[model samples]
Target: MARETHIEAYDGPAGGWGSAKSVGRYVLGEGAPLRTTAALAKQNKVGGFACVSCAWSKPRDPNTFEFCENGAKATAWELTSKAIDASFFARHTLRELEHWSDFALEDQGRLTEPLKYDAASDRYLPIAWEQAFAEIGAELNAIDPKAAVFYASGRASLETSYLYQLFARIYGTNNLPDSSNMCHESTSVALPESIGVPVGTVFLEDFETTDFIFFFGQNVGSNAPRMLHPLQEARKRGVPIITFNPLRERGLERFTNPQAPTEMLTGAETTISTQYCQVKAGGDLAALFGLAKALIALDDAAAESGGPAVLDHGFIAEHTHGFEAFAGACRARGWDAIERGAGLSRAALEQAAETYARSTAAIAVYGMGLTQHRTGVENVQMLANLLLLKGNIGRPGAGICPVRGHSNVQGQRTVGITEKTKLAPLDRLKELYDFEPPREDGMATVDACEGMVAGTVEAFVALGGNFLRAIPETGAMETAWRKLRLSVQIATKLNRSHVVHGRAAYLLPCLGRIEIDRQASGPQAVSVEDSSSHFHGSRALVDPVAATLKSELAIVAGLARATLLPNPKVDWEGWTADYAKVRDAIEATYPKVFPGFNARLDTPGGFPKPIAAREREWTTPTGKANFIFPESLDENPDMPAPNPDALRLITLRSNDQFNTTIYGFDDRFRGVDGTRMVVFMNAADIARLGFADAGTVTMTTAADDALREVAGFRIVAYDIPEGCCAAYYPECNPLIPLWHHAKGSKVPAAKAIPVTLRAAG
Candidate 1:
């Protein structure tokens, strides 16, 4: 079935709405509408449920949707009243479920009964909560503590995250493989090195005041729909937004907000970016370096004219270190190198730099697109260096914003789900639970995959995630996970992981955040922090689909009780009955940081956590901000000299998709429809390959030993640079080698993949 890239036809924009509405219907199985609902019943109250979409904070203002398109989808998914009990499981075997599409499988709705995978039946059978807990404990107790690994998702609540960390520490292992290790690890590794803060310094208000916004490697419209409104507003205010991405995203060009009444009435859309530059995949580093070099030259010229220099010499000298080294590196790089590497001319780069210099405040917002490269950490540091020349960090309307994926991904890490870094929380846990926490470092996401591939890990407890499919090196991870003795998953619905069975696998159904958990102690509220570092309460608004479904807190407690430390000093039962007790433990653990956790929840907007960037505090060794020069801007290896036979391939997501989940087969913005298997290439590339437009094509892995092939793909002409092509991820994921990952974070280089195109059979 090996085939070349081909084009069937274009599916119109309005056509996809039907599909979107269809997915919406599937997600909102059975939920009634209600007005005058309490704060907890409303979607986005400080005391209500957190938006299941982007990490953008909701203002106290009631006008905004508080929910984006994706947020609405997330909320609908959570509020769905569909049920998946033992009867549903009996009707579908694990093997059969394995054959289902990701959307169809998740669409089957919420889990109800605690179930274990039956080898003979190849289906999950219902088990009592007590038995499930006993089995988990017995399995963990039999295995070496070092062999057990804890996998966490970003969807976990703050209380659950804290307790999970404590449980792992007391259990004598620090193998916390969290979602952060996959997405923003580069930001975590680089920001501290450059500007003294790992998170964004700009609050939502900063977006309103910034003069120019430089968005590098982010698709804000689809990824964070809330960003579109602000960006549109900025556009209307005549603020320039220069976008540098490998692909010319449709959302970046224009957006018609469905929420805006005027636009909807007139069928009008607001234009977003003033200038769009399509850099080569992995060429972001080069583009950034080129811009900085241009700015430095501008500064020198401005100084000669007796005008204020384009650079903030005072800020650089007072707040930062290593400016000299970075300056030297920029000065040494020639214009030819910059032009060739960045795929942009000196004039184009200067125009971009001049925009930065002229603006009162310039904010650079990025997404996983920046953090998923080989030199991702260095890339982020370079971005910081560019901003520092103009004093962008810790300013009124400027800073670096990393758009985190998953609603509470950042919050999950903030509370405690880290592998090795322990704040004063350990002592508090000791006092509250009478057990010493582990001090050793734990495995990161990359290390976990490596461990599984090496077969040292014998057990994995996945707390709500699609670990195997979500991770890279699917083949290697599957091989290693199959060697494990047990794998336990606490989830609200079915996913690929349940079918990727371990020797002893259990799928423990848990309650969603929107459901009411009426336990022994009465109703409870869970704490969730947003990306902006504001912690608030989440109370269940809807009743659980079935009475048997348990909360994650309850499930973890039952397992802990059944397994190690039968007489554990921690109030596991109390925390399960009421999550506030768990928050009390969190507050006690970090008094200076999380003091008055309960009292603060009553505030209008939850209290802000400590942000070093806000106060311009440097937590580094020198007590001053630092800057380091990356070796080069060429994030990708040099291409083979004038090889007409080779083509560079980058993976992308369709408008109808998010990560591995395909809502439908239409990408409305890209003028694509009814398909996920299309590749975009420049006209010259298609002509050079001797392929006709809209013809069938095949993509084969660049590596000689690899046999991965994506067939029946349609080739379409795009505004892309010559010799570069793009396709959807996971479908093309087989072409990405496990060994090809970022140097610092080890995340897969999905943005820069090498592949060869062929004519289809």
Candidate 2:
């Protein structure tokens, strides 16, 4: 292939010349330097579009160059000058395009028209929007509403998301799963039970005064590079940052702000973390227990000596539940088990505890690493327990921060996109629309796949996403997708998902976030919420690439109109004509939470949504924060005994990748060049496993079936902890079974896969 593997040392600080060069290459290489350059300038700025890459909230006062390398790439990729229309689709058959990679399919450029799959010719032909919608509506009307799966990606704005979910509920199904279900569903599921809110309580501005930042799991450099600036500033202010991760991430270790003239001119690097501990894969729960245990031990010592209280007694008594049982459970877990399970020394755990105890306000930040495990829900709860020991939640510069990857993932979920029945406020929907909402639980990401495999899921409607590539068991999902009777995709561009169509499929082109959406009223602006619950308006940077393109909101409304013809309850036409009406309807549904929604859109840097947890107002059933006691130190209970010979495979994303979209094959952060078919292993493990450095090896899963495996992966010596290995995601997705997911959250346990390796023949 593209060179087996080329590993080198990447000692340079993150976000320097390397980041700048990558941004330059991507933006300039789009063949529309001026157009792409202008789009980058408008990103994250007032009255401009939000960055479609990551959901990091914007500062109250944004910089002139507020975008990061990933943001630049996403912006450039969307603002491409290339166009692929009906003629191009006619030239390429679906079977031929099935062989193309996801990146190659999207790189073909934007979908220019509504097209229907022609099974006889194995090609797609242009069709009128009304005709396509009518056909799709007819098919959906014929099937049971519960059998349809309505999926939305994070790229959808709040306006579109609201309408999209409403459409699904009105169509008689709660199968409203979105991109958030795949990534941060654990945070969403656990945080509410632990702290009475599904989202993190810390604000973007909280970084300025935070005493300590405990970063876990997430690599900010690749996922959300804009986060580095605040962390670097926190370091400059002498705030000690403690990091816990399996791989030594370059972003969490050191960062040089590319926007800072002095750093760029002098090539100066800012040390991000005071201490970095390499926690084993799927060891976050054990590590959290260790930290909590240390905190309790310190408190016990202080109590006897009449010293300053280590635990916040007043806060615990006033605003918490289950502290006694949780603390006792922590005391029972010995240091030996903690150290063994966490892959960290007692000294490191104690040091982290000390740092955490000393800080008046600390923010516990995490990403998919903590959430993508069998004990993902427990991982979040354990983290909350640690934060509660020092009363870190619901205060300025404190609490949890589960960083989101998609731009408006949290927003989409906030505006009623979920598989759960009660989360959508069915009561309000009925009161407003006078329709009976679905009460039964619906299909999530995994359930949707199972439904497809079982021939029960008749139709699949995706707003935007590479569903096949994003889901687990890629091979199985790819084949099962063909079982669907209808597959309707509303997207800005073509992707591999389009090629792997159902029995009948339709591709409807929609306007991109960067393109101006001129509805019947006038140019309309959309809104999105960041990871921190900050809501803001996003206007277009340029005109639509094609005249035939429609806004996502319009498309969803059009489909709803076709499906439920002559429905007087929902005003789909009015909502599509003017998006302000949609906002008004949203406010009508959640008035207290979204009052003056339309007027607030003009706020300079947007407004922060009200979070009950941030105000220490616990809205849980207990009316206070609750401490959770995990079942065991071993997060992966399904996993057998901890065998030293077995390797826990953790999936990673390259610096040049975003989700399933591969920008390039170069990952400067890990020193991987020109190839993604490589696995990172410790030097000792390499020798212990009897594999030479850079030698090709085949990895087979240790599951009961033992069918999941990948061959021809080069083993590169890395600095990871023993008994663990790392490889790029989506490439290794084939080895992950669809059933291997978190216990409660059902999120794919991608962080830790049991596997074994042997020399490739």
Candidate 3:
């Protein structure tokens, strides 16, 4: 049954009673009141499991109520009372369930036991874990090692990720495509080339000392609610907060800390953004160039007047290279081009530049909006360039922060969840496990999709993500996945991917992070690295939803034992039994970074991993941070001019959702309720396109070679840029071509799609 649609301007501040009410609804909806409360209490606690939401780091001394609204929803969703058993599968056929919405499919609840698709009945029948493992092993053994694609989700812990990569390498395949290939691969690619590391240098404490903070393309309220506390504190401290985004996000506009009883009870809210600049959907690079250009002009004028220079000349001379060429490129970018490309006036950018110039210390934060574009890598590098101009890196209260989604995603990469095979990690693995790791590069997420379409990929295995729904061009990807000879999904809940089966499909139910993991040795705690690179131990407080549900480590071990013939001398069972053993192995593999892994876990607040870039010790080829100068502002430099009638479309996430998981249809922050198929358009654009404010429309991609369209989208007039529009993803994912991705990063350019709107037939 569809709920009634409601649209109104949201006047309430973020993170107040609204968040509390949403969290309360989710907790009650889970149906196990006591258990849900207990489980939530255990989340983000000192010794309890980390929240499975965003990777925002927990406070050193976290309050009793440490979880946020999104975190609460994730917890409730995972620990829900509902269950999907063999009988539930028998009630519905694969074809019948295929038409269900992504939310409906997952809301069927936790998978209680292992299931295997029965082609005859077109249903998922119960299967023993051993039988499923044997079948998967047989299919894997039958195929060439290179034909198998092992996909990893960021939700997997460091231990599970390490074991997964080991299993893939032992099976003689380097095709390890992961969620990072779709999200922060741009940061992973660009940061290392520009600086010396792939990770951000900022710590949680950095927010306190910053004089100015700039947020680009990040909506802190929905993505990471915990971040609002610091931003609120920064506001109280009189720090200038600048925001650059296509849409006006409420979290960036103002916030009310629910934790503050006085503010929540009294209705007082903290003003967040001192200045908000609505940059065009693919225009971050141009805007950044404009900011840099304005800064350069101010510096030149200062130098001519024999006044204090705006640029950090000392930092540039000592810590960076290619400044001369980069500066020249920035200065050469004309104001007209910048204004046209960024959809911002020259005065607004200059005002932002002036605010940035006056600050002694500043931090630049960004999210998927900047990274999910054709120039995603360049967009990130440009942020780095902006920071480097005033020596933002390697200092307190200042650095580049690509606020990553998914807890432990960064940790997974830290523990070697990558398609590229580095010799150092390989050698370390060999020294620790006595196995020769593959040297060749593996397929990324896009490459794996292409491989599946080409019929070169034989098998597919996912650790914990909804692969089919998360990827771009869902129509093509769904078909490609079905063509595989074998597909395996190890997850807690049933999703769209489970119904869209391959020749032989297995659904292996695994324990969620909040559930206790009891192994042969003893109870174990898995470690995860937060976005800030702090590693902490997580132990579940609640029992598994079903006794049959296996831990991710156990499943990986079972697959390894069943598949890898004549196994090496490594003790997979021992490592799985005691996660401390896994930590020991991690220490052995990466001695310098993870030194004394077990010992470090004992330290309160966990140990912050050493970042060479933070210490200004650049290990880049130039032995210093390299400044990159792009030839053009356009993400696709060779692309044809955009259609005059076409609007730039960006896929967004509702406040009620995270990634592909929809908790509800409401996007309270944006004042959208009861629908996921609505598109946000400027009032002027709506008027120009001859559509009413709330008119229904069909959005069709303007791609020359491919025609991708989605119908029945309600157009909601919003305070957005004139020629730009926004829609929630997975629903809008069909319009983004798989081939339209960032250069070098291969991340889908979901935020820069060109689309034309027509009245619904």
Candidate 2 local lDDT, 1-761, one digit each (tens): 24454689898989999999999998887777898888888789878889988899887788879999999999988888888898997788999999877667878878888999999999999999999989999999999999999998888999999998988988899998887778899998999999988889988888988999998899988999999988988999999999999999999988888998998999999998899999999788789999999999999999999999999999999999999999899889988998999999999999989988999999989999899998899998888998998899978889899999889989998889999986889999998998888898888999999999999999999999888888888888888998899999998778888999999999999999999898789899889888888888899979888999999999998899899856676889888888999999988988977899999986766788889998899999999999987869887787666566789999999998998788888899888888888999999999998889999998888865648788979888999999999998888888888888988888998999988898988
lDDT of 3 by residue, 135-233 (tens): 899999999999999998898999999999989998888898888999999999999999989989999899989999999999998999888888889
Candidates 1 and 2, the one with greater lDDT: 2
Q: Rate the local accuracy (lDDT) of all candidates.
A: 0.75, 0.89, 0.89
Model 2 TM-score, 2 decimals: 0.98
Q: What is the lDDT of residue 548 in candidate 1?
A: 88
Worst 10 residues of 2 by lDDT: 1-10
Q: Number of clashes in every candidate structure?
A: 13, 0, 0
The residue-level lDDT of candidate 1 at 677 comes to 74
TM-score of each: 0.93, 0.98, 0.99
The residue ranges of model 1 lying beyond 4 angstroms of the native Cα positions read 1-41, 62-64, 422-432, 602-605, 637-644, 703-706
Error of 3 at 304 (Å): 0.7
What is the C-alpha lDDT profile of model 1 across 31-131, one tens digit per residue? Answer: 53231123123666755676655676655453344555556666666556566878987788877777776667777778888999888998889888898
lDDT at residue 593 of model 1 (Cα atoms)? 65
